[model samples]
Target: MKVIVGLGNPGSEYAHTRHNIGFEVIDYLSEQESIRLTKNKFNALFGKGKIGDTDVLLVKPLTYMNASGEAVGPLLHFFKLDTADLLVIQDDMDLPIGKIRLRQKGSAGGHNGIKSVIQHVGTQEFARIKVGIGHPQHTREAVVRYVLQGFQGDDRAAIDAAIERSTSAVKAWLTQPFSQVMNMYNSNK
Candidate 1:
C-alpha cells in the first residue's frame, strides 16, 4: 500500500494559503478519484481507495504543519508499512512559483512539516513531491506572512497549474518506480 501524505495546516482559515498547497493537491487527487476525505485517523483526515490498481491512502494531517509527525508516525505503525511506502507532498519556498521537484530522499530544507515527518518516520528514504511557492519580495521576516497568505493575481494561475501537475506526479508514483518518476519530474521543465 502507498500512503500519500499532504502536509498542511487544517481549518478553513488556512484554505488556499501558500503553505496549504500540499493539501490542495490531495484535494485535487481525491476529486479526480472520486474519493471523499471524511474519515479521521492518526490525527488526520484521510480517504482510502485505489487509483489504477494501486492501493492508496490519502492523508491530510490535522495536527498542523509543524507537528505533522504526530499523524504520520502512527499511521505507519497502524498500516505496518515502512518509510519507503510513504510520499509527502509539500510547498518549497526556494524554487520558482509553479515549479516542482521529486526526490526519493532528502533533508527537510527548513520546512517544519517535512522535519516533523522525518522525526517521526525516523528516515528520509520516502518519496516526495515538492511544489514551489516562491518567496516574498520584501523582508525575509515576511516568510511567515507570505506562506499564510493566499495566492493573488498572476500567482493564482501558476499555483493552480502546479497543484494539477503535483496531482499528476503523485498518480504516476502510485504505479511507477520512484527512480523513474524522479527522473521524469526532478528536472526543470
Candidate 2:
C-alpha cells in the first residue's frame, strides 16, 4: 500500500495557516476519493481507499509538525512499508507562493516536520511534494509568525491554486513512478 502523509498541527486554531497546507491537500484528496479519515492510529488521522487501481492510505499527522516522525515511523513499521512507499506533502517557504515541487529524496532543508520524519524513518529517501508558501522576513520570529498565519487576498488565491495542483500531483503519484511524477509536476514550476 502507498502511504501519503500530510504534516500539520492539530486543532482548529491552525486551520488554513500556511503551515497547514499539507493538511489541506490531504483533505482535498479525501473528499475527492470519498476516503473518510475516521481512523486514529499512531497519533494520526487516516483512511484507506483506492485511488485508481492503487491502494492508498491518506494520513494527517496529529502530533503537529515538529514531532511528525513520532507518528509516521510507527505507522510505516506497522504496515511493513519501506520509505519508498511513502509520500509526504508539506509547505515550503523557499519557493514562491503557488509553486509546487516534487522530489524523490532529500534533506529537510530546514523544515522541522520533514526533519522529524527523516529522523524517525531513518532515511532521507522518500518522495515528497512541497507547496510554496513564500518566505517572509529573515528573522526567526517573523518566519514563525508567517507560517502560522493564514494567507490573505492574492496570497490566498495563489495558495488555493497550489493546493489543487498538489492534489493532482499526488494522484498522479499513485499510478506513475515517483520520478515521472516529479518530472511532470516540477517542470510546471
Candidate 3:
C-alpha cells in the first residue's frame, strides 16, 4: 500500500497558518473521498481508502512540522512499506507563491519537517511534493512569524489554487509511476 503524508503542526492555533498548507491538501483529498481522518496511529490522524485503484493511507502527522519523521518512519515500518511507497507533502518557501515542485529525492532545502523525515527514514531517496508558500515580502519580519501567519487577499487566492493543483498531483501519483507523475507535476510554474 502507498502512503501519502501531509506535514503540519497540530493544534488549533496553527490551523490556517501558511506552514500548514500540507494539512490543507490532506483535508481537501479527504473531503473529496469522503474519508474521515479519525484513526490515530503512527502519531498521525489518518484514513484508509483508495486513490484510483491504488490502496492508500491519507495521513496528517500529529508530531508537528519539525518532528514529522516521528510519524512517517513508523507508519512506513508498520505498513511494511519501503521508502519508495511513501509520499510526503509540505510547504516550501523557495518558489513563487502557488508554485508546486515534485522531486523523487532531494535534500531538505531548509525544511525542518523534511529534515526530520530524512533523519528517521535514513535517506533522502524518497518522494516529496513541495507546495510553495513563498517568503514574506517584508524581510524584517521574523521568518517563523511569517510562516505562522495566515494568507490574505491575493495570497489566499494563490494558495487556494495551489492546493487544488496539489490535489491533482496526488491523484496522478496514485495511478502512474511516480517518475511519470513527477514529470507531469514538477513542470508546473
Candidate 3 per-residue lDDT over residues 22-91, each given as its tens digit:
9999999999987789999979999999877888889999998999999999988898889988889899
> What is the C-alpha local distance difference test score of each model?
0.91, 0.94, 0.89
Error of 2 at 123 (Å): 0.4
Candidate 3, residue 36: lDDT: 83
List, residue by residue over 1-189, the lDDT tens digit for candidate 2: 999999899999999999999999999999999999999999999999999998899999999999999999999999999999999999999999989999999999999999999999999999999999999999999999999999999999999999899999998888889899888899944
Q: What's the residue-level lDDT of 38 in candidate 2? A: 95
Off by over 4 Å in 1: 137-140
Candidate 3 has an lDDT of: 0.89
Give per-residue CA lDDT, model 1, range 78-141, as digits (tens).
9999988899999999988889988889999899999999999999888889989998866767
If the candidates were sorted by their TM-score against the true structure, best first, what order would they fall in?
2, 1, 3
**Alpha carbon lDDT of residue 149, candidate 2?**
99
| Candidate number that wins on TM-score, 2 or 3 | 2
Report the number of backbone clashes for model 3.
0
Clashing pairs in 3: none
Candidate 1 yields a Cα-based lDDT of: 0.91
Give me the candidate number with maximum TM-score: 2
For candidate 2, the clash count comes to 0
Off by over 4 Å in 2: none
Query: Against the hidden reference, what TM-scores do the models get?
Result: 0.96, 0.98, 0.95
